[model samples]
Target: MPTLVVAVFLAFFAAEYAVETGLLLLNLRRARRSGDAVPAPLQGVVTPGSAARSRDYTLANGRLALVSGAWSAALTLAVLLSGLLPWLHQALAARGLAGAHRFVAFLVLVSAPFWVAGLPFALYRTFVLEARFGFNRTTPALWLKDRAKGLLLSAALGLPLLYAVYGFMALTGRAWWLWLAGFLTGVQILMVWLFPTLIAPLFNRFQPLPEGPLKERLEALARAARFRSRGLFVMDASRRSGHGNAYFTGFFRPRIVLFDTLVAQMTVPEAAAVLAHEIGHYQKRHVHRRLALGVAGQVVTLWALSLLVPWPPLYRAFGFAAPSYEAALALFSLGGGAFTFFLAPVASWLSRRHEYQADRYAVALVPEPGALASALVKLNRENLANLDPHPWYSAWHYSHPTLVERLRAIGEAGRPA
Candidate 1:
C-alpha cells in the first residue's frame, strides 16, 4: 500500500509538471508567432514597439517560470523521497519536544529549505527580469527589509494558529476536524476584516484620496451605483514596482485602494471608470460569492484531511514511521498541488466571468462608456502585459480575459440595442 501510494504520488506530480510546462511552452510559442505587429483590435491603441516589448516580457517571464517550477518540483521530490522528514522527526523526538511545540518546529524546519532555495529566484526576478522591463523599483535594502518583515509576520501570526489547530486535534477527539474547520473559517473572516486596517499598513502607506476632482468623480460614481464603501484611498505602490492596480479590501467597511502609479497614469474619467468596475464587483456580490466558495473549499479540505490523517499508508509513503496529524498535514501541504492543479481552469473561468460582469456594470455606470476600455488598453501597454496568449493557455491560467477579448466585449457593450 505504501509503495502504491508513492507511485501514485509520483505519477500525479510528473503529470502536473508536464502539463504546466506544456502550457507555458505553448504560450511562449504563440507569443513568438505574433511577431512585432500589434493585433488589429489594438492597432492604434498601442504602438508596435509596445507590442514587441510585451512579447519579449512574456517570453522572459515564461522562461523564468519554467526554470523555477522545475527547481521547486525537484527540491520537493528530493525532500519527500530522501528520508529526511523521518530523520528530522526522530531528531526532534530525541530532544524531548512533543505535541504542538514539536509539530511547529518540524514544520518550520521543513519549510526553511524551500524558503532559502527560493531566495535566489526571487532576487533574480525582482532585480534582473523585472528591472530589465523597467518595472522593478525595489532596492536591495528594501527587498531584504520586506523579506525580514514577512518572515517575522508569518511567525507571529502562523505560530498561534498552528498551535490552536494542534490543540483542537488533540482535545476534540474525532470531531476535531469540524472544530478546526469552524475556527479557521472564523479566522479567515477576521483576517479579511482586519487586513485593510491592520495588516496592509505594515508594508505600504495608504492615504485617503485627496479632496479633488478624481475623488468627487469616484464618489459620485459609487453613489450612482448605490455602492457604499468606507472611503477611497491611494497606495504607494510605486515604491516597489511600476505596475498599477486597484482593489477593494475588507468584508465590512471595504475601502477602495488605487495604486499611485495607476492614479498618475489615468485621467479623471478613466480613474472613475476603474473605481466603477471595482464597485461593480460589490454590487454584483462577487466578493461575497467568492468568500462563500472559499469557505466551502476550506470545509471540504478539512473533511478530506480528517479521512487521510489517520491512514498509516499515507504517512509511510512520505517516510514517516507512524500515522500522525502533523505528518499528514505536512505531506498534504506539499503534495496537494499535484491533485489541485486540474482545478485551475475552473477557477480561472469563474474569475473571468466575474470580470466581464464587472466590466459591463462599469460601462453602465460611467459617464463615458469608452473610459474603461481605454483604461484597460493603457494598463496593458504600461504594464507590458502579453497582448496575445494561446487560447488554451489563457483559458487555463488567466483570471481575466485577454486585452483583445476585453476590448471586444466593451465595444459590444457600448453598441446600440
Candidate 2:
C-alpha cells in the first residue's frame, strides 16, 4: 500500500511538472513571437524601445528559468530516488547529535550543497543578465555581503525556531503537527511585526520619507483608510535593481515603503496613487486574509506530514533505512513543490481577486482613477513586465492581474486607460 502511494505521488509529481513546463514553453514561444512593436493597450504606457527591451528581458529570464529549474528539479529528484537522504541522516547521526540539533544541522548540511550549486546561476543572473539590461546595481562585494547576512540570519532565527518546533513535537506525540501549526502560525504573524524594524535593516537601508508633499499625501490616505500607519519610509532599492515599487510592511503599524527609484521616476501624485494602492491592501483586510490562508495551508501541510512521515516505505522510497524526522523534513522541503504545483492557479486566482478589490479601494481613496492606472503602467514599463501573457500562464503564475486586466478593472471604476 505504501509503495502504491509512493508510485501515485511520483505520477502526480510528474504530471504537475509536465503541465507547468508546458505552460512555460508556451509562454516562451509567445514571447519569442511578441515582436518589438508595442501592443495597443500598452501603446501609451511603454515606449517602443522599452517594449523591445522588455521582450528581450523576458526571453532571457524565461530561458534561464527553464534551464535552472530543470537543473534544480533534476537535483531534487535524484536525491529522492537515491538513498541520499538516509545516507545524510546517518552521517549526521554519526556526529552524536540528537533531536532539533541533529535536525537543524542536517538541514544546513543538505541545503549547503544546493545553495553552492546555485551560486553560479545567481551570479550570472545578477551580474550578466540584469547588467546587460542595465538593472544590476549590486556590486560583487554587496552581493557577497547580502549572502553572508542571509546565512547568518538564517542560523540566528531558524535554529531556535526549529528547536522549539521539535520540542513541541516531542511533547505532543500524534498531536505534534497541531502544536507546530499553532506555533508557526503565531511566528508568521509575529514576523510581519518584526520585519520592518528588525530583519529588513540587515539587507537594505530604510530611511524615513523626507517631509514634503509626498509624505503629506500618504499620511492623508492612511487617515482616510482609518489606518494609523506606522510611518512612510523610503527604501534604498537602487542598490540591487532598477525596478521601482512600493509596499506596506509590518502588521501592528504598517509603514509604507516606496522605492527610491520609484520616487525618482514617478510624479508625487502618481507615487501617492501607488501608496494608496498598497494602503488599500491593508484597508480591505487583504493582508489579514492572506495570513489566514497561509495559516490554513500550514495546518493542512503539517497534518499531511504527520500522516505521511511515519509510513516506512515512503522513507524507503527515498532510501531511508528507518523513519527520521530530519529525513522527512529534507524530503518535504526539497520535493514538496512537485506535489503542490497544482495549487498555483487557485492561489493566483485568489490573489488576482484580492487585487481587484484593492484597486477599487485605491481609487476610492485617490479619486483620480487614472493616476493609479498610470502608476501601474509606469511600473509595468519599469519592471519590464510582459504586457500580454497567455491566459493559462497568467492564471497559473500571476499573483496580480496583467496591465490589460488591471486597466479593464480600473475602467470599470471610471479610470480611463
Candidate 3:
C-alpha cells in the first residue's frame, strides 16, 4: 500500500511538471512573437529605444520553461534512481546500511546530477539573459561569492536540522511526531527572532535609515497604521541583483526593511507609498494570520506523518524493512516532497489574495495610486519581469498579481466613486 501510494504521488508530480513546462514554452513563444514590450506602469514615464524594448520583452519570458523542465527532470530522476539502492540493501539484509543515514546519503548523491545539470543554465540566464536586458549588475566574482555564501548558509541552517529530524524518527519511532512538531516550532520561532539581527547581516549590510524627511514620512505611515516599528532598515541589495523588494520581518517586534536597490530608484513620495503598502499588511493583520495558518498546517502535517510512520506497508513498498528507521525516514522525506507538488498552487493562491488585500490597504492609506503603480512598473521592468503572462500559469505559480492587474487596481482606486 505504501509503495503504491509513493508511486501515485511521484506520478502526479511528474505530470504537473510536464504541464508546467508546456505552458512556459507556449508563453515564451508568444512573448517573442510580440515585438513591442508590453506597457508597464513604470515605463509610462521613460521612453526606450524600440530595439531595447524588444530585447527586454524576449529575455523576460524566454528560458523559463527550459530551466524549469530541466530542474524537474533532474529531481525526478534522483528520487526514482535512489530508491534502487534501498531495494538492493533490503534484498541483501546488509540492513545496517539501509537505515536513515544511508538513505539520506543516497538522496544527496542523487541530487548531484540535478545540481550539475541546472547550474550552467542558471548562470547563463543570470549573466547573459539578465545582462542583455540591462538588469544584471553582478560581476562574475560577486556572483560566485554569493553562491559560496548561499551554500554555507544552507549547510549551517539545514544540515543539523536534517540530522536531528532523522535521529528523532529513528530513536523515538511512534512518538517522533510530538518531538518533530516541537522542534519545528522552535526552529521557526528562532529563525524569525534571529533573521533581522543575525542571518541578514551575513549576506547584506543593513543600516538604520538616515535621519531625513523620508524617515519622517515612513514613521508617520507606521503611526497611522497603528503599528510600532523597530526602525527603518536599508539593505545593500545592489551587490547581488538589481531586483527591488521590501518586506517587514520579525514577529515580536517587526522592522520595516527596504532594499537600497529600491531606495536608489524611487522618490520619497513613491518610496513612502511602497512603505504604506507594506504597512497595510500589518494594518490588516495579515502577518499574524499567515503565521497562525502556517502553525495549523504544521500540526496537521505532523498528524498525517504519524499515521504512516508506524505502518509497515509504507516501508516495504518503498523497498525497506518495517523495523528499519533509516528506510522509514527516507520514504517520509520523499512523501513530503511529493505532497508539496499539489499544495504549492493552493498556497500561492492564498498568498496572491493577501497581496491584493494589501494593495487595497495601501491605496486607502497613501492615496498616491499613481506613485504606487509607477513604482511597481519600474521595479518589474528593471527586474525584467514578464508583463503579460498566461493566466493559469500565473495563477498556479506567481506569488503576486501581475503588473497589469496591479496597475488596473491602482487606476480603479483613483477613479471618483
lDDT (tens digit, per residue) of candidate 3 on 110-201: 44565666777779878977676666788888888877887788778876776777777767767788788888988998998898898888
lDDT of 3: 0.72
Tens-digit lDDT track for model 2 on 256-361? Answer: 8889999998887788788777877887788888888998999999898887778787787767788877777777887777688888899999999989988887
> What would the TM-scores of all predictions be?
0.98, 0.96, 0.85
Task: List residue ranges in candidate 1 displaced over 4 A.
Answer: none
Supply every candidate's count of residue pairs whose N, Cα or C atoms clash at under 3 angstroms: 0, 0, 3
Q: How would you order the candidates by lDDT, starting with the best?
A: 1, 2, 3
A best-first ranking of the candidates according to their TM-score comes to: 1, 2, 3
For TM-score, candidate 1 versus 2, the one ahead is 1
By lDDT, the best candidate is 1
Across 24-130, the per-residue lDDT of candidate 1 in tens digits comes to 99999999989898989888888999999999999999999999999999999988999998999999999998999998898889899999999999999999999
Please give the distance, in angstroms, between residue 102's alpha carbon in candidate 3 and its true position after superposition: 5.3
lDDT scores of the candidates, listed in order: 0.91, 0.84, 0.72
Comparing 1 with 2 on lDDT, the higher-scoring candidate is 1
Off by over 4 Å in 2: 1-6, 415-417
